[model samples]
Target: MVAKIITGKTIGGVIRYNEQKVKHGQAKLLQMGGFAVKNLTVNDKIQIFKQVQKLNKRTKTNTVHISLNFSPKDKVNEFTLQRIAEDYLKGIGFENQPYLLYQHFDAAHPHIHLVTTNITWEGKRIETHNLGKIKSEKTRREIEGRYQLVKAEEQRKQKVNLLQSLEKAAYGKRETKASISNIVQEVIRTYQFASLPELNAVLEQFNVCAYRGEKESDMFKKSGLVYSILDAAGNRVGVPVKASSIYSSPTLPRLEKMFFRNKEARKQHRETLRGQIQEVLKSCSSLDEFTSRLRPKGIKPVFRINEEGRLYGVTYIDNVNRCVFNGSALGKDLSANSLSARFSLNADLPYDLEREQEVKMGWHGNEPGKRTQLVESSPNSYQTEDPTPYELKQKKKKKRKKRIQ
Candidate 1:
C-alpha cells in the first residue's frame, strides 16, 4: 500500500488538494488532529508537506513517489507504511530530514506522496542515495525480520529463495497469473477462475468469506488466503493471489464485527473495551486483577495472537481462554503528538507477576500516571477541531517565524 502525490505550488495563498473528496466515497474515512502524521506519515497523511515542496524542486518533477511494501496483507497497517519508509530512508539515519507526505489515487496500488525538502530540517541539502540506500537495506532486513515485504534486489543479494524465483519466472513470461494458476487449482479451487467474482460464487456454498484483511492493509487478498486452498490434511498450492483472486460470498457477507466497521460501532466497542481492560488492571493491581476484570465480562485477556483464533487478531487470551481484545496490528499503535499511546511494556504481565512488577516499576517508576492504566484501543482520540481563519493564518505565520529564526 504505497501512495504517490503530486504537490501543487502555493498560488494565490492557496494550494490545491483533496477537498473532502472521500466524504461519500466507497470508504468514508475522516482523519483529524495530527491525523495526517499519525495515520499516513509516510504516504497519504504526511505532515512534513513542506518537505514535499522541496522534493518537487529537487527532483524537478511535480510528482513525489513512494512504494509501500508490506509483510503479508494482514500485517500491513499505518505502521507498515512508516516502517517501509523508515527502512528505505530512515534506517540510515535520514530521520532528521524535512519532508511532508501525501497520496495520489491514480492507481490501484496506493503509494505515498513524499514531498521532502532537499534540505534538512536544519537547512542542509541532502544527497540522495548516500548512506540512505545502505540503511534502507538494513531497514528492509528489519521489516522482513517480522514479516515479508516484497523481495527487493537487496534481499536477492542476500540469498536465493524458491517462491521468489517462481514469481519472477511467472512475471517475465507475461500473463504469469494465467500461467501459474494451474498450480493454484490443484491446491485450491479458487485458482480455477479468472476473477475473484468467479471465486466468490464458489465460497457462497461453503460459507467462505473475505475481510478487509487488516484495516488499512492490502485492498484485496488478506494474509492467510494464500494458504487456504488445501485438503483437510493441509497443503499449499497457488500462483499467489491478487485481492481479486479469491471470491467471497455476496456483499462480503459473514463479515466479522471489527473495530473499524461502523464509526459509531467501532468507537463504542473500543471505548467500552478500553474501560473494561483498564478497570481490570486498576482493580486487583496484580495477576488476580487481570483475571478478575475479565471473569465477569466473560472476556479473557489474550497475550499471544493465537489463543482463541483470528477473531480480532487476538491469539493469546488469559488462562480462562475467553475472547479478549483481538490484537490490532495498526489499532493500538502509539504516537508522539497525542496521548492515547498504548505499548506492551508488560510482556511478562500474563506470565509472571514479579516480571510485571519489575517492568512496571522500571518504566513508570511510581509516577502518578502509572496508577491509572492507559489503554490505546479507544478510537477517536485524534479528532480535529475546526480551526478559524485567523487561527489558521496564525499557525502558518508561526511556522514561518520558526523557520526564519
Candidate 2:
C-alpha cells in the first residue's frame, strides 16, 4: 500500500473534492471517525470539519488530506478498507482527529482518500513535518502486512509492459473524448514525467500526445493545453480536447506542479535505469542493438534524430520504475553526445562473449573481466575502457602493412 499525505490550509476544499466524486457516482463515503454523528450529509461534513479547523486558528495548514493506494491485484472489500483506514489513522497518530474516508472508483487501482484535520479537540495542532516519509511510511508497511495487501515497492519492481497493456486512443473505434480522458488521467496519475516531451514519450506509445500551439497563438499565450489522438504515423488525427475538459483537469498549471513533484519522486529509480543501460552497453555494438536489448528488460529507448539523420537526444522510459528520464538527466556519460561517440566506436565490432558474460555475472564484483558498475563510475570512465577486439585486429593489420612497406 502507498500513502500520500497532502497538507492543505482549507479542509472544505478537500471535503468538497471527495463529495463531488460521491455525487458523480465515482466515489462513496466509506467511514468517518471522531464524530458523534454516525451519518452526515455533505454540507454537514464540510461544516463540521471547518468548525474543527476554526479551533486552531494559528495552524495555517492543519488540514491533512491522505490517499491510500492499493494495487489492482488486491481484492479489498469495503469492510476491509474501513478497518485498514482506522488502523492506518491510529498508527499515524490521527486516532483522535475527525476524518472521513471515501472509496474512489475513478482509477484502475483500488484506493481511498482520507480527509482529516491535525487539530485536536483541545485545539492542539499535530506536527506534520516529515509525516509522509517518516510516520506514514512505517504505518503503511504495517497495514500492508496486517491486511496481506500488495506492497507498493513490490508493485514498482514488476515490469509494467505498458505498450502491450494500454491500448492507444483510436479516434473512430470508440468515443474519442472518453478514450483520451482515460489515457490522460491514467498517465498523469501513474507515470513520473518531468516535462511534456518526457510525458509524450510515454503517451505516444499509446497513440496520444499533449499539444500546445505555436508560441504566438492565443491559446499558447493563455497557457492552454490540449490532448490529441495520434494516428499510427504519429500525426494528430482527431479533434483536440482541452486540458480543463478532462475529469482530472490536467491543465498546464497542474501538470507543471506534477512535473516538479515527479523530478524528486523519481530520483530513487535513476541509478537502476543507469545500471541497466550500462549493462546493455557492454555487448551492444550499435544504437539499434542497445534499443533491442533494453526492451526485454522493460526499458523503452526513444531516440531523437535530427533532420541530418544524426542522433541528438535520447530518453528512457523505465517500465519497472514507471519513470521517464532523458539521457542527460541520467549523467553526462549516458547523454546523447557521449552515447553516440561510444556507439560509433563499437559500430564495427563483433559481440564479445567475455564482456557479455561479465555483465550477466554482475558488473561490479571481484571476478576477473567484471567492471565496476556504471552507477558508481565517474562520467569520464567510459573513455578508459580497453580496446575492442575489432580495434585490436585493425591495429594489427596496420602493423603488418608497415612491416611489408
Candidate number with greatest TM-score: 2
TM-score of candidate 2 against the unseen true structure:
0.60
| Model 1 C-alpha lDDT per residue in residues 38-75, reported as the tens digit of each score | 45422343334455445345543222233342212224
TM-score of each: 0.25, 0.60
Query: Tens digits of per-residue lDDT for model 2 on 199-288?
Result: 887888888878765443456557678888888766776688899988579987777777777888999889988998988988878888
TM match of model 1 to true structure: 0.25
The per-residue C-alpha lDDT of model 1 at residue 217 equals: 28
**Residue 303 of candidate 1: its Cα lDDT?**
32
Give the top-scoring candidate (lDDT).
Answer: 2
Report residue 149 deviation for candidate 1 (angstroms).
Answer: 3.2
Worst 10 residues of 2 by lDDT: 353-362
Each candidate's lDDT (Cα)? 0.32, 0.75
